[model samples]
Target: MSTAVGGTTRPCPECGARVPVDERFTVWCAACDWNVDPGERQEHRQKQETEKRRAKRPGQGRLEEARRALARRHGERLHTEMTRDGADLRARRDGASVLAYALALAVHGVTAALLAGGVLCLVWGWGGGLMLLGAVLLVMAVALRPRLSPPLGDGTVLRRADAPELYALVDEVARAVGTRGVDTISVGKEINASVISRGLRGRRALDLGLPLWEVLTPQQRVALLGHELGHYANGDTRHGRVVGSALRSLATWRYYFLPTPRPSLGEMIVNAVYAVPLLLVQGTLSLLDHLTLRATQRAEYLADREAARTASTEAAAGLMDQMLVLDSIDVFLRRESNNAALAGARSARRNAAGAREGGDLWTRLAAHLASVPEHEYERQRRAGARRGHSVDSTHPPTHLRRAFLLTGPPAEPAVVLDEAKQRRIAAELATARAEVARSIVRDGVA
Candidate 1:
C-alpha cells in the first residue's frame, strides 16, 4: 500500500464489498468498513489469551477489570461534576486542587531536602563516604530540578513584525477567551499546536505544527487558538510548575532506578538494590497522576468550552472531528513518505543516487485529507467511541469531549476570521509551511 492510489479497485475480504483502493493505502471496505479497525476484530483472540493467562494466575483478569471499572466510575462522576459546573471555572476550586498543590510542594520539598542534605554531607559531615554520597545526591537533585527548557528555537520564532495578521488573529482569540495573547508565534514540524512559556518572566509562545495547522480551516484555526490560550486563562495544575515538575522529577527518578533486561550478576544485584526505590517513585508518580487526572481533564473541557464560545460550536466540533481522524492523517503521511522512498530507491538504482521529490508534501497532504470520504470519518468516529481514546492521554475521551460540546448551549463566533485576514495568515505561514513539508519528505515521519 506504498504506491499512489487511483490504479485499481478490489473486493473487501470481510464482506465481498467493492472498495476503491489501489496499492496506495489501507484497503478497507467502504461499504461494510471491513478492516477499518483490525484491532476491534481481535477481541475473541484477546479474550482467549486472557483466559489462558488467567488459568496460570487466578483472578488476574478480574483484578484488572475491577481496576478499570473503578477508574471508569471515577471518570463518570468527574464528568457529571464538570457538567454541573458548566463552563464556569471560577468557583471550581475544591479539595482535589488543594491536595494536588500540597503534594506538589512536598515533591519540591524532597528536592530541596536533597540539596540541603547534600551540602550538609559535603561540608559538615567529615568522611569520604559522606562526600561521595553528597556528590551523588547533588547530581540527582540537579537532574530533578524544575526548569523550562524552551520548546521553541530561535530560527522557528515567527515575529509579530513578520506575521501581524496571524498575531492579530491570535490576540483577538485571546480576548474572546478572556486572556492576553501570547508573546510570539512559531511554526514547527509537529502535527500539533501548543502554548508554552519560557524564562523567569514566563513569556508565552504559541507554537503551531504546520501539518496540523494547514489541515485546519480558518475558523477551526480560531478554535485551536481559543483552546491553547484558554489554558493560560484557566490555570492548569498539571501544567503548573509545582505539580508538573513533581511529575517530571518522579519520572526522572523512575528512569534512574529502572530494571534492565538481560542483567549481569552485578547488574542483577544492583537492580535488587534499586527495586524498592523504583517501586516507590513509580507509586508516587501514579498517585500524582491520579490526583491530577480530573483537574487536567477539566482543564481540557474548559479549553474546549472556550473554543466553542470563541469560534462557534460548529467550528469547535469541526476541530474535534479533525482530532478524531488524526490517525488516518498520520497513516496517509507515512504512506506518502514510504512511496517517496520507494520511488527514490528505484531511481537510485538507475541514476546511482536516490532523489526524493519535495516541496509538494503539503499539497499532497491537503489533497489526501480532502479526498477522505465522509464515511471514513464516520468510521473513525465510531472507532474512537469504541476505543475511548483522546488526542492526549491527559485529556478526556474524544467522544465525551464531543458530547460535552454538542450537549451544551451553542455560541456564535465571537472572534471571526474574514476571508481577507485568512489569506494574510496563510501568506505569513507560507514559507514555514514549505520548509516543514520539505523536511517531512527528506527525513520522513517517525
Candidate 2:
C-alpha cells in the first residue's frame, strides 16, 4: 500500500487512523489501505446456486478449464522470464515471431501478386466483366496495402508553442525513457492515454485522455508519461504498420465474409461459398495474435517498470489504484453529464460557432473520485480481480501489473511535476478541459 507522501492528514473512516491523503488523488487510509483495493467480501453464496451457464455442449466446460489452466501456466512462464532479466527489456523472439513475420510478408506478397495479375487481366482481357474483375482485384490490393494511421480528427491539439511547460515535462520523461518527445499533444474526454506514431513521417503524437489526467497526482502523471514513452523504447509489433495493417485487413475481410443474418436460400449458398475464406482469415488472425500477444504483454510490463523507475514506485502504484477505479470514473462521468441538476447549464455547449466553457467536468470528477467510499472501492477491486480484466486483450491483468510495480525496483522521480509547472500545465489544458466538459455535458460522455 502507498503511504501518502506530500498530502495533509485525514482521519481514516475505517480505523480512525490518521492518514495522509493527497489532494485531487486517492483518498484512502495509508495505514490500513482501507479504501485501496480490498478484495473479496466475506459474504457467501448459496451452495445450490451456480454461475453454471453451460456452454454449447456438455464437455465444453472441461475443455475450457484445461485451456484456462494451460493459459495460466503460459502466463506464469512468461512472467518469470520477463522478471528474470531486469536490465534487458527487449521482447525476446521465439519461432512463433519468425513464423508471424513470414506470414505477414506472405500476405504483402500476395497483395502484390494480386495487383500485378489485375493489371495483366485488364490489359489482356476482351470481356467487360473480366476488366471489371481486374479493377476489383486492383482495388482490393490497394486497400490491403500497409498504410499509416490517420488523424484522430477529435480532441484539442496542443503543440510546443501552445504548451511549452507540458512539452518540457513530456520531453524530460521521453528522455528518461530514451525516446524523442512527441511533436503534438491531443487531449480528449476518454479515460485512457497513449502515444502513437502519426502520418507517413511517423510523427509521434501523445494522446492525453483529460479525465484520466485530472485525477492523477503530479508524480503519478510523470509515471503515466513514463509508461507511454517506454512504448517507444519497447518494440511493440502490434503498432508496426506491416503486421498491424495486415491484422486489420484480415479482420475487414472476415467482416465481409460473415454469413447473412436470417439468410434466404441464395444467401445460405453464398455463406457456404465464403466459409473457406472466412476460416482462412480467422486462422491467420489467430496465428498472428498468438505470436504477437506474448511480446506485446512483455512490452506492457517493461513499460510499467519504466513508469515505476521514472516516477517513484509509490506514485506508480497510486496510478494503478486510479486505474482500478476507471469504471467508476466512466459511470460517474455519464451520470453527472445526465444529471437533472446540470441539464440547463449543460445545454449551453461550447462549439465552433461560439466557444462557451463547460460545467467544470474535471472538478466534478475529482469530487466523485474523492467521495467514493472504501466499501465501494473494495467492491470494485474485488470485482476486477474476479473479472481479471486488463486495459486490453493484449495487456496483462490489471492486478498483476499493480503487483509487478510494487515488487519492481524502487526509484526517485527523475521528472517531478512541481506545483509551479503543474499550474502552468493546468493552464495550458484548461481550455481543452472545458471543451471536453462541454462536449460531455451536451453528449452525455459516452
Candidate 3:
C-alpha cells in the first residue's frame, strides 16, 4: 500500500511507479521508498486549501442580472441626476442631519446627570455607595469618547518635496474636481485609497496604497485621484468625520458598560446592571447609522460621476472594475503571502539560518495573477461577484456603477497624460511599492 499527498498523483521519481493521491499531506511511494519533505507536503496542502476557499463565495448572478436590468431601464436618468445634482443634495441633507449630534449629547448629558445625582445623593445616609458607582460610570463615559482621528498604521507620508511630479498631477486633479488639495499624501501597504480627516480641524489626508497604484493604468490613476478629491469637493469627508466619530464613541461606550458575559460572577453582575441603559444608547445610534448608510452609498455614486467628469467615462468605469476585482484578490493574496512567509521564517529558525526567503512577496503574487489566463480570471471573478442590494454596504454595486458610466454623458476637456509623465509617475510609485513590500514582509515575520 502506498501513502499519498493531497494534490495530483504523479509517477514516483525513483522507480517510475504510480503514486496515489488522497487526503493525507505526505506522499510516499512504498514500492520505491519515495517521499516528499514535510515542508513541500505542507505547502502543497495549503495551496489546495487556499484555492478551494478563494473560489467559493456564494455567487451573485441573479442579483447582478437584476441590477443590469434596472440599469438598462433607468440608468440614463440616474446618471443625469448623479452628475448634475447628487453631490449637492447629499451634502445639504448630511449637513441637515445635525440631529446626529444628539447621539453624542445623549451620552455625555446622561453621564453628567448621573454624576450630579450622585453628588446630591451624598446628602443622605448610604449615599457613599451610590456615589462610588456614579464615579465609575462617569469615568467610563469619559474614556469612551472616540479618538478624533483614524489610525494611519505603517503609512509613509508622500510629501510634495518627495515627488513634485506626483503632487503636480494630484493638484491638477484637485483643480479639475473644484477642491482644495489634500494636506498630505501617504502611501500604505494595502490595496485601497481614500481621503481621511486628521482631527477635529478636519485636515484632509489622502492615502494611496502602493499595491493599487502599481496595477493601475494612467487614466485609472486620474480617475481614482478625482474620486477621492471629489469627497472633499462635495463635503463628504467633512460631514462623515462628525457622524462617524459619534458612531465610534457610542460603540466604545457600549463596550465598556455592556461587555459580553464573563465567567466571573462580579463582572457579570456589573454588566447586567449597566446593560439596560447602554441598550437605549446603542438603539439610538443604530438608527442614526441606518439613516447615514443610504447617504454614504449615494455619496460614492456621486463621487464616481465626479471622477467621470474630471477624467474620462472609460477611465472612471475602468477604475470601478479594478476596485471590484482588486478588493477580493488583495485579501486572498495577502493572506497567502503572509502564511507562506511565516512558514519560511519558522523553517529558517529550525535550520538556524538568520533569515528566510520569499522577499517581494506582493510583486511575486501580482506577477502570478497577471499571468493567469483570461478565461480563468473571468471564472474567478464570477465566483466572487457580490450580492446585490447589500443594505449595509457603503458603496453601490460595481456592475451598476459600470453600467451607469457607460450610459452617462461625456466629459469636456478630458484628462490625458503624456507618455513621459506617465513613465515618471510609474517610477515614483515603484519606490513606494518597494517601501510597502518591505513593511509587509517585516511585519509578517515579526
User: Among these predicted structures, which one has the highest TM-score?
Assistant: 1
Per-residue alpha-carbon lDDT of candidate 2 for residues 292-352, written as tens digits (9 for 90 to 100): 7777887888898889878988998888888878977888777755563353543333242
Q: Per-residue lDDT tens digits of candidate 1, residues 305-413?
A: 8899999999999899888777766787776666666656664442221123446777777787787766566666666656653322688777677778887578899
Report the Cα lDDT for candidate 2.
0.74
Report the lDDT tens digits of candidate 3 across residue range 355-383: 23224555565674454333333332342
- Among the numbered candidates, top lDDT falls to 1
lDDT of 2 at 401: 78
Instruction: List lDDT for all candidates, in order.
Output: 0.76, 0.74, 0.63
Q: Cα RMSDs of all predictions?
A: 4.5, 6.3, 11.4
- Candidate 2 to native Cα RMSD, angstroms: 6.3
Every model's TM-score: 0.85, 0.80, 0.67
Model 2 ranges with Cα > 4 A deviation: 1-59, 84-88, 126-129, 150-153, 264-266, 340-342, 345-357, 373-392
Q: Rank the candidates by lDDT, best first.
A: 1, 2, 3
Clashing pairs in 2: none
For model 1, the local distance difference test gives: 0.76
